[model samples]
Target chain A: MSSLEKRLAAEKRFKFYGMFAMTLSLFFVLILMYKIFSTGSGAFVRTTINADVYFDPNFIEVSSNSSKKEIMKASYVDLADQVINQNHPGLDEENFIKVREMYTRKFDYQLRDYIVNNPNVIGKTVNLDISASSDLDQIVKGNYPRNVPEAQRKINDYQLSILDSLDSKGKMSKTFNFWFFTNGDSRDPETAGILGALMGSFYALLICFSFAFPIGLLASVYLEEFVKPGKITDIIEVNINNLAAVPSIVYGLLGLGMLIGVFGMPYQVPLVGGLVLGFMTLPTIIIASRASLRGVPPSIREGALAVGATKMQTVFHHVIPLSLPGTLTGTIIGMAQALGETAPLLLVGMVAFVMEIPGGAFDPATGLPSQIYLWSESAERGFLEKTSAGIMLLLSFLIIMNTVAVLVRRKLEVKW
Target chain B: MVDQNSNYALQTSEVYVHYGKKMAINNVALNFPKNEVTSLIGPSGCGKSTFLRCLNRMNDVIDICNVKGKFLLNGNVDIYSPDIQVETLREKVGMVFQKPNPFPKTIYDNVAYGPKIHGIASSQNELDEIVKDSLHRAGLYEEVKDRMDDIATGLSGGQQQRLCIARAIAIRPEIILMDEPCSALDPIATAKIEDLINELKENYTIIIVTHSMSQASRVSSKTAFFHLGNLVEYGETGKIFTKPDKEQTNDYITGRFG
Candidate 1:
């Protein structure tokens, strides 16, 4: 064969290899996204049952003049027990326990809140939308396979019978689960939500952005613009690049030792998580920012200087504006990376189960990634879907951050 | 504005420039007579552009560049004095580059940038008038007045160069330095800029660097010819073009040597 023909054939083979690799990567990403969406989409729509809760006047002594604290401190679980007993007439004690298991632990709190919020509803039958427990929820949502026998399934025979009864009665309703978005981490996956972790991630990212954005940009500006190249600069450059590649877990360990151990900062607080993630993200931002600052044309600087602008004015007015898009993109990339980081957070104690949403940076918190890790390690069978759901939340946040960066780049980047 | 017809606008004595021990501009003494055009003509790397940059201290941005000279402006002010800010020096003398570099802003803003930085205009109305006046003086107002809000970079090449000239003129400098300002233009654009320069010399003293000998003869009153970092000839443009003073200058003008 002619050499030209041989070269063409070789080129075609290389092209095929590249295309195959790209297709393989895209296929895996597609499968991963599909798997995550399918498994986690079910978590957002929970199965609920309508319990005809009759508020007897004797049970709830909440008068119109009663203060909110007095109304809250009163016990109202007996009203829920009365409704359950009144509805299930022939159920014995053993079967009644299984019926009680069908309702969420917060059922009484729901009834009390309804009564307190609407004091005029006394002696009226209030149809409270009671959330089914996770086991019955799984069965109603079709997660618990009906074809499987009682011995083989995680749900016991009594629980299945209760779920079957609720299903046959047509009282079960699938509704959007607002609690998943509003509640805190819990031992019961049924009550768990991402609000605490989301807030924690926000606080951590706020700290990361507030610190890393300026410090990283200033360090880059100083190194690239002010400092002259020499052995020291070379060493600094090499160290910064190497820091960007350092194992993130080491930063976690550093935070564990320094911030929590020596500095006595509170563990699992977004403050310490933020500081550790800031250290991890610093090199990334600095490297990206320096590269962008270096990309500006020397002619622009000369132009500004020739116009009698001082060095500081030229940088602040011209250079900063021009490099802003890249700077923002780099910061977002750093934030997204910090958001998904779990191992470092684990070391810094962000893996602890937080019951309340963090009120501030110093409050105990768990990030989304840490929450996912915590759920995945739990022995409860219900936490499997919860872990996948947590992962979906984390991925959505990352997607949002990246989309914002792309939009900023498109809108603000200058042609020159 | 000084009434003395023979007053010199700028003077340089024993000026030397070096880049880390390599001489870029050798000891050279030259004078720019007030309210007239002076042209520096040389071959490639003859330090003409280097000499042009020295007037406004543009080379100060480079760390390795070392300049030593006595520069007197208006026959009294020592430009290289310890207390003389480079910003003030640049404000007194503006520069046009070889490549037309308009900031990535509107044409109006390009002309207004220097004035805004120096606080020459106190209000929006005054700033607009200044931009209009500067653009009119640069001979760009007629073509660009309707689209002053457009980005300066979107203009044609020669228009962009004229916009840069307007930007320089907006500073109201006493002297303007042009470093081959029309070298990147076509013959037609070059002709337009030459006419503009001839008209501008009436209001501002100009120093221009060019490799085109014809350009030096057409636009300048006095011409300094440089060769190998040294001034080989400094004389009236008519005499320097016709009468031979230095062998190297003659050879360069006649295209026999560079």
Candidate 2:
């Protein structure tokens, strides 16, 4: 072949290689997105079994005038058993207990809440929708493998038949699972929600941003604008750059040893988690802030100084304001990265199963990633969907944060 | 110490500037007469701009630049003295840069920045008056009067340069140092700036650094020639153009060599 033809062939091959690599990466991303969506979409809806529940006076020991606390202390298990027996009459004790197991453990709490809220409904036959158990929910959602033998499957033939009968009668249906967004973590997967984890992450990020943004900005400004370049400053610069590359788990270890051990901060609290994340995020923000500050043209500084502005005034008035949009973009990108981090949170005691929504940064809580991590380790079939759902939530948050960063840059960026 | 009775507006004695180990400005002593336009002409890298920066201590902003010698403002005040506040020195000696480096702010703010920082205008009305007067002096008031709130950078290059000049004059400095202010402008803009400089000589001591020999003769009464970091010639513009005292100055002006 001619030399020119050979060169053209080599160039074509190089272009093909680049295209292949791009396509390969895009393929993996598409597959990952599809898998997460497919598995997680079920968590947004749950199965409910509607029944005529008699608020039987024989089982309910509280009167209409009874306080909520007194009503809550009544025998709810008997009430639930009596209601389940009424729904499935002619069942023996064993079958009656099995039928009662079809409902969620928190179904009793739902009944109790209903009676507590509406005292006029006492002894009345009320039509109520009860949450089905996670096993029944999986069956209704077609997530459970029915092809497997009854011995190995989560639901047996008898239970499946009963679920099918309920479905045929229009008593069992799938509805939007508001509790998935409202409730906290629970041993029962059907009742678990992300509100606690969401609040935990919110408080942690709030504290993280408060601590990292100003400290990083000031540190970068002092280093980039104020400090003269010398041996000491060169060393400090190298160390700060190195800090950005350090493993975040090391920062978690530091938080555990210094913040929790030495400082006596409570374990599994968002405060310590946020402080650890802040330390992990500081170098990122500092490096980004310094880059943006350096991007400010020297002409602007000279203009301010030539106009008799002090060095501080020159930086604050002209240099800093011009670099602010870029600095904030970097800060938000760093915060987004911190939001998805899980390993460091594990070391900082944010891996605990927190059931209550965090009231403040100091309250014990688990962040979204830690909650997802905990759910992924569970043995239940229902937690599989919840794990993917939690991951989806975390990714959406990252996307939203990065979008805000881009929008802020577009809005506030100065052309010059 | 303040010296009000001196005939010269600024005088430098044996001023030497070094960028690290390399010397940029040699021993150069020159006096700028009060209320006159004096132009420094030199080829590229000849230290004319460096010497101009030394007058206002603008060289202090460079981390590696070292300037030594006596910079006496109005014959007696030592500009480089440790007791002197740099801000006050800069306020007294305003500068317009080579490029039209107006702040990315409104036209009014660009003109008002110097006076605002120096606290010269006591009220909003006073600041507005100073901004108007400075813009009028820079010959930009007629073109930009209707758009005072618009960003200064949005204007044409010539207008931006004029806005920078207005910004400098708003502080009402005694000496105005312009370093190649017309280099980035077109011929028409250059003519307008030259005319503005001619009108400004009655009120301010103007020291301009230019590469154009014709510009030096057009705007300045006195001209100084710098060659390779050394002041080679200092005379009237007519003498410097027609009959230079130094052979190198003659060679540079006559298009023989830089």
Candidate 3:
């Protein structure tokens, strides 16, 4: 072959290599997305059982004249047990317990709440929807293997038969799991929701951005525009870049030693977590901000300075505005990275199993990644799906953040 | 030292520029006469632009650049005195860069920035009138009158250069220093800039640095030739082009060598 032919063949080979690499990466991403979606999709729907619960006064031990406090304090477990035994008569104690385990443990509390909220329902039959146990829910959703031996299966033959009967009668159904989005963490995965972790992550990011952005911007401006390049400035620049690459968990240790240990701040709160993550994210914002500030063409600075503007005026009026889009893009990416960070948060006490939704940044809370870590550590079959679902939520937030970064860069970047 | 002439608007003596020990401009004393266009002509890297930036202390922006000089404006004010504010000096001596460096702002804002910052205009109407008059003086108002709010970067290269000139003039400086203001333009645009310079010298003392010797002859009344960071020749434009006394100036003007 001629030399030209060899060159063309080499070009073709390079193109093919690039295409293969891109396709391989894309294939991996698709597999990951498919795995997450398939497993987590089950967590978005919950299995519920409908029952005609008769509010018997004898079982409730509450008369029509009974006070609301008396009704609330009444033995609701007995009433629920009676209702289950009435549907399946002549059951031994073991079978009875198995049947009772099909519904959520909190059904008694739910029944008491219902009666206290509605006093006129006494002595009348009311149709109600009850939450199923996590094991029964996994079975109902077909996520659990049914062909396994009776000893191996979580739902045994008898319980399966009862569930099949309920299914046949259309009393057992799958509904949108609105509770999964609204409730906080729970030992029972069926009742678990992301609202607590989501809020914790939100507050942490809010605090992180509010703390890091202005300080990072000002530091970068001072270093990039005002300070002369010398031994100290050079040392500072090198250390700032080095901090960006340091293990984030080290920042957590620093936060633990200083913010919690020395300052005596509360632990497991997003405020502390946010402050820790802010320390982790500060170097990133400063490096990115300085880079963008450097990218602002020197001619623009000269233009402003030539107009008899002061150095501060030139920077604030021209340099900062021109670099803002890049600075913000960098800041958001840093926040996204902080959102997915777990080890630093784990050290900062954001890994605590918080069950109530955090009302404020100072409240005890766990971020989404730590929540996923907690759920993934559970030995329950139900938590497997919950883990994937939590991952999905976290990944979606990352995607949204990255998309905003790109949009901001495209929208605000001056073409000149 | 050059002769002390009261007719000169600006005078600099014993000016030396060092960039961290490497000399860029040697001791070159030159005086710019009042209301006349002077062109500093040199090849690339001859420090013509560096000398031009020294008049307003624009070189102070470079950390390693050390400029030692004595500059007198209007034969009285010591421009380099420790008490003098650099911003105030820049207000008196404005500059246009080699590139058309307009701010990424509206045409009106680009022109109004200098006046606004210097507090030359007290009211909106006064700033508007200043902007309009500057643009008209720069020969851009007629073409861009309807699009004053449009971003200045959207204009053509020549128009952007003109807008920069207008921005420099809006503060009503007595002297305008232009560093190769037409090097980035085509022939037609360069011609337009040369025409604008001729008209501007009636009010502002215009000192331009140009590489094109023909541009020096066409636009300037006096010319200074810098070679290897040294002032090789300085004389009237007519003498410099027709009968230069220095053999080096004659050789350079006759295209013998840079």
Candidate 4:
């Protein structure tokens, strides 16, 4: 072949390679998305077992003037039990226990919430659809194939008929799982939720943004404008670049050593987690902000100064406004990277099981990635679904954040 | 400090500029008379721009650009003194750059920026009046008066240059230093600016740096020629172009060599 033909052939091969690489990456992403969606989609909806929950006014002993605490202290399990006993009058003792186990572990609490929300439901028989146990949930979700022999099934022939009878009576339903959004982590997979992890991530990110953005921008401005190139500046510049490339988990170690050890703060609190994450994110923000500052043409600065404006005025009013869009884009991307980080969080003790939703930054918490890590390690099949669900949520939050950054850039970016 | 007069708009004596010890402006002295047009004409990098920048301390922004000079405003106020506030001096000596740079804002905002920053205008109506008057003085009012809110950056190059000139005048400076203002314009636009310069000299002391010798002759009464970082000649525009006193000035004028 002639030299030009050989070069053209090389160019064609490069194009094919690029296309092949893109397709390969896209195929992996799609497969991962499908697997995650199929696994976690079940978490967003939940199975419910219909039951007759009679509110006996005599049992509650709740007056209209009674405090909420007094009403809450009353037993709801006995009321639920009375309804079950009345329905199956001739049931044996062992069968009765099995029937009771079908209700969600938090059935008592769920019944109490309902009564508190509806005080007039007293002395009335209400058809309440309560959460099913994860084992029952799995059977209803078709994880336990009914075609299997009685010996090989999670639900036996007797239990299967009971479930089928409930379904035939329109007492078995699958509604959107509101508890999965509102509750926190639970050992009972039926009540496990992402709220605690979500709140922890929220508080951590809020603290991270509040501290990192201004500090990063100021550092960039000082280095780019005030400090001239010299020994001190060189050291700072080199170190900042090095910081961006350092392992993020090292920052967690720093947080553990400095915040928990020296400062004596409680472990796994969102505040310290945020501070650690902020340190990991600072170098990213600084590098991005410096790039943004560099993108502004010097002519803009000269123009402002020529108008008899002070140095500070010129920088703040002219140079900063011009670079703000790029700066914000960089900041958000950094924050997203911080959000998905898991290794550093493990170092800071964010892998612990947290049930209560965090009320403040100081509350002991676990973020989404850490929550997913903990869930995925569980031996139960239920946690596998939850882990995938947590991954989906984290990915969505990242997508939304990046979209907001893009929109902000589009709105604020000036052509000149 | 030698027999300095306070009436001339600007004066420089023994001015030197060093970029890390490499002299860009050697010892030089020049004068700009008030309410008249004076042009500095030179080849590229001859330090005419550097000398103009010293009058307003514009060189202070450059870290390596060291200026050592006696720069007198109205001839005797030592402009380079540490006691002098650079902002106040810069307010008095306004500069227009070689390229027209209008802020990426509305035409009204561009014109109002100077007045706003210096606190020269007191109220909304006063600011509007100042912007309109400045634009009128720059000879760009009639064309852009109807669309004052339109972005200044979106205007034509010649129009943008006029807007920049308007912005400079809004501050009501005593001296306007224009460095190659017409360099980026077409012939027609250059003619318009030259006409505007003739009109501006009635109120403002205009010190213009131009590479175009003919532009200098057309707009200036006094002319200074710079060569190799030194002032080669300073005289009336008519005498300097027709019968230059120095052989080097004549050589440059007659195109013998740059």
Candidate 5:
């Protein structure tokens, strides 16, 4: 063959190799997306219990006739007991008490209201479908091994029997979980939700936004637009690039030492979490912002100057508006990365076993990743599924945020 | 053809430019005519484009660039004076770069950017008129009028260059500087730009830097030749092309050696 034919063969081989590489990369990305969705979807559906239990009129009538509001509150537990007894007539005293415990611990006042409002229907059956305990729910959902030794299981044979009965009767089904929204961290995996972590994350993000946005933007402007490119500026640029690659967990360690240990700020609080994440995300924000600012051509600056615009005016009016989309996309991506980070939160005190929803940023709490960590370590057999579910929730948030970034970039992308 | 209006639109005396410790342009003194085209011709690395950029003080944008000596405009104001703002000087002497450097924006936005930044137009309608008129002057309006909102980058290379020229003209500058405007253009586009330069000279004083001696002869009223950062000759374009002032200038125009 001629040399030209050999060159043509080589060119064809190169094209084939390029196509193969692209296909391989796309395949891996698709597999990753599939795995994340498959593992995480189960966390959104929760098993609930549906049953009809009689409400006794005798307990309700006494509370209704009482003048004092305090006496009316005493009937709450009595109503719960009546419902349990009416549902499981053949069960022994201990078994009945265990069944009664399945109702929400916060539903006492709600039970009392139901009894007082419906005295006529107290003896009659009232159909109620309530959230099952996480362990029992896990058993019904086949999360717990059916063949496990009775002694090894957290749920006893009796509770399993009750769950089995409920399942056979088609009274146990997965429902949209309200507890995932309203509840907080519990020693019980069934009671765990992201409310505490979500609040903490929000507070941390607020702090990050306040600190990172202005500082990062200003630093980027100075580096890209204002400062003369020289030895000192080159050094600063190199340091910023290195900072972006620094381990986020190191920032957590730093925050733990400085913000909490040295500065004497409250531990397990969002303020410190925010400060750490801010430090972790600052380099990313600054790097992205500078890149976006540089993306604006020198011609725009020259054009503005040629029209008698001051440096400040050109930057604020033309450069900022053109770069705003890229800046926002960077910020969202940074926040999303911060959202899924567990190492830094672990270094800080976000791993506390918080049982109640945090009221504010300063309120001590565990975040979703930390909660997942907490659940995975529990001795309870049911917490494994809850851990999986928690991971799912965290991953979904990241997906949504990244999707928004992609959309913003596509919508506002400017080409020169 | 030195008109009465041929007072110094721009003047440079003993001007020197250094990049770090290395001298780029040395002791250059020249005058640009009002309402006429002055073309600077030289081989590569001869500081022709550097001399053009000096009129608008664009060298200030480079960190290592340092300038000394007098750069005056309108025979009175020294543009290099401490009190003179680079922004104000650039406003009077608008520039078009070698490669068309239109912003990553709509053609309308690209043209209106100058006027909008300077607040030359009070409203959107006025800004629109200014953009239209400038495009018309740049000889680009009829070709691009239907798609002014399309991204400037979408245009052909020639169209993009003309859009940049329109962008510079929109500022109502007294002097226009072209830095190898036709270097990246096709022969047809170069011809169009040459025609536009001739038309522009009727309203604004124009200075251009070109490596093409034929281009310099065809477009310019006055010509200056530079060799190794030194002004070798300056005279009427006709006399410089037809006759001879210096052996070097003659040899250069005749294609003996750059």
Candidate 6:
């Protein structure tokens, strides 16, 4: 063949190779999406019991007349017993108590109060489909392998039999889990939800946005737009670039030492976690924001200046609006990175087994990643499913954030 | 004979631009006549563009670039004075780059950007008028009038260049600098820009840097020839093109060694 013919063949082969590579990439991405969806979609639904538990007036009066602290201590078990008796009226006392104990080891004071205040509820049974323990719920949801040995399993054949009976009677089902939103962390895998972690993550992200946005944007503006490139500016640029590449866990260590150990900040709190995550995310935001700011052509700046705009006015009024889409994209990406980070929060003592949603920034609680890590480490088989569910939640958040970034980029894209 | 004092538009006396330790433009002294096209013609790397940039203090944007010269604008005002704002200096001397760099925006927005930022237009109607007039002056309105809202990047190379020229003119600069403005355009577009330049000379002083000797002859009244960081000759374009003056200038115009 002639050289030109050979070159043409080579060009054709190269095009074929590019197509093959693109196809393979698409196939792999599809597989990944399929796996994540199949595994994670199940996490959104949870098996719950639907039965009416009549509130006992005598129990409430007894609890109220006693010391407030004493009543609080007994409330969980007391409510559990009342609920069990109301659900299974003919069951023996021992079996009824055992069923109540299976639901929650602690007192539920809130349940007792609802029974006492509503006089109409004393004899009338209120429909209460309380969340089952994670182990039992997992078995009902077909997540737990039924072949596991009875001794090794937290929920035995006897409990599974009861659950099966409940299912047969149409008392158990997978419902849209409102408790998942309302409840806090629980040692019982069935009762555990991300409400506490969500609150913690919210406060931490709030702190990150508040602290990082201004500082990162200002640093980027100065570096990219305003500051005269000199030795000092060069040093700052290098430092910022290096900081972006630094491992986020190091920021956690810094937070552990300075914020908690040195500064006497509370450990396992959203406030400290926020500060740590902010430091970790700051460099990312700055680098991204700087690139966006720099992306604005010098002609635009020159144009603004020529129109007799002051440097500040030109930058703030014209340059910033143009660069905002890029900055927002960067900021969202940074927030997404912060969302899935576990190592830094681990170092800052944010992996505590928190049983209540954080009341404030200073309240001790775990974030989503930290909660996932915490759940994965537990010996309970129920937590394994919970961990999978938590992974789904975290991944969904990341996907949402990235989608927002993409949309913002498209919206703000200047077609120069 | 041209009068010596017709309020000189721009004057440079022994101007030197150094990049680090290396001198880029050495002891260049020249005057730009008002309301006329002054073209700087040279071989590559001769600092013609560098000197054009100096007129607007654009070299200040570069970190390592240092300019040492007493340059004056409009006879007595020192352009390089510390008190002169770089932004304000640039306002009076607008520049069109070698490659058309219309902002990634609608043709209308591209033209209106300068006017909006400068606060030259108070209302949308005023801005629309300015954009239309600027585009008309740049010889781009007729072709692009129907699609003014389309992205400037979608236009042909010559059209985009004209749009950039329109963008520059919208700011109402006194002196417009063209840095090889027709380098990226075809012969047809080049002719159109030359025609526009001739018309523009009535309202603005134009200094154009070009590598084409024919382009310099066609557009400029006066031409300055620069060679290897030195000004070889400055005279009327007709005299420089035909008459014997500098051996190097004659050789260059006759297509000998640049």
Docking class of 6: acceptable
Task: Report the lDDT tens digits of candidate 4 across residue range B198-242.
Answer: 999999999999988899999999999999899999999999999
Colliding residue pairs in candidate 3: none
- Sorted on lDDT, highest at the top, how do the candidates line up? 3, 2, 4, 1, 6, 5
lDDT of 6 by residue, A1-416 (tens): 99999999999999999999999999998887777667655556666677777666555544334554544445445556767776766777666654654454433543654544543455456776666666666677677778889887667776777777887999986777655567788877656788999899989998888888888898899888777778998898899889988888999999999999999998999899988889988999999888888888887766555445677977887688789899989999999999888989999999988998998898998999999899889987667756777787888889999999999999878766
Q: Estimate the overall C-alpha local distance difference test score of candidate 3.
A: 0.92
Query: Residues A1-416, candidate 1, lDDT per residue (tens digit)?
Result: 99999999999999999999999999999999899888888878887887787888777767657788988888888887787887777888888777888887777777878878987777888776788788778877778787787787766787776666777998778889887899988777677888999999999989888888899999998898878889999999999999999999999999999999999988889999998999999999998888888877887788888889999888887787777788889889889999999988999899998999999898999999999999889976567778889999898889999999899889987775
Residue-by-residue lDDT tens digits, candidate 5, A363-403 = 88777778888878987655665676777778788899999
* Pairs in clash, predicted candidate 5: A55-A122
Candidate 1 lDDT tens digits, B127-189? 999999999998989999899899888998899988888898899999999999999999999
Error of 5 at B120 (Å): 2.8
Regarding DockQ, does 3 or 4 come out ahead? Answer: 3
Better of 3 and 6 by lDDT: 3
| Candidate 5 lDDT, B1-258, residue by residue in tens | 222233879877788888899888888988897898999998899988888878898887777888887877888888989999888788789999888878777899989988876788999999999999999999999999999999888998899989989999999999999999999999999999999999999999999999889999999999999988889999999999989689999999999988
Q: Which of candidates 1 and 2 reaches a greater TM-score? A: 2
* Residues B41-151 of candidate 3: C-alpha lDDT, one tens digit per residue: 887889999999999999999888999888899888888899899999999999999999999999999999999888999999999999999999999999999999999
Q: Which CAPRI category fits model 5?
A: acceptable
Q: What DockQ results for candidate 6? A: 0.31
lDDT (Cα atoms) of all candidates against the true structure: 0.87, 0.91, 0.92, 0.88, 0.81, 0.82
lDDT of 4 by residue, A152-205 (tens): 765667667777888899899998988889999999888899999999999999
Q: Which residue pairs collide in model 6, if any? A: A76-A107, A76-A108, A133-A190, A134-A190, A416-B104
Model 1 misplaced stretches (Cα beyond 4 Å):
A146-154, B1-6
Residue pairs with backbone overlap in model 4: none
TM-score per model over all chains: 0.95, 0.96, 0.93, 0.96, 0.86, 0.83
Better of 1 and 2 by DockQ: 2
Listed for each candidate, the true contacts retained, as a fraction, are 0.65, 0.72, 0.84, 0.67, 0.58, 0.42
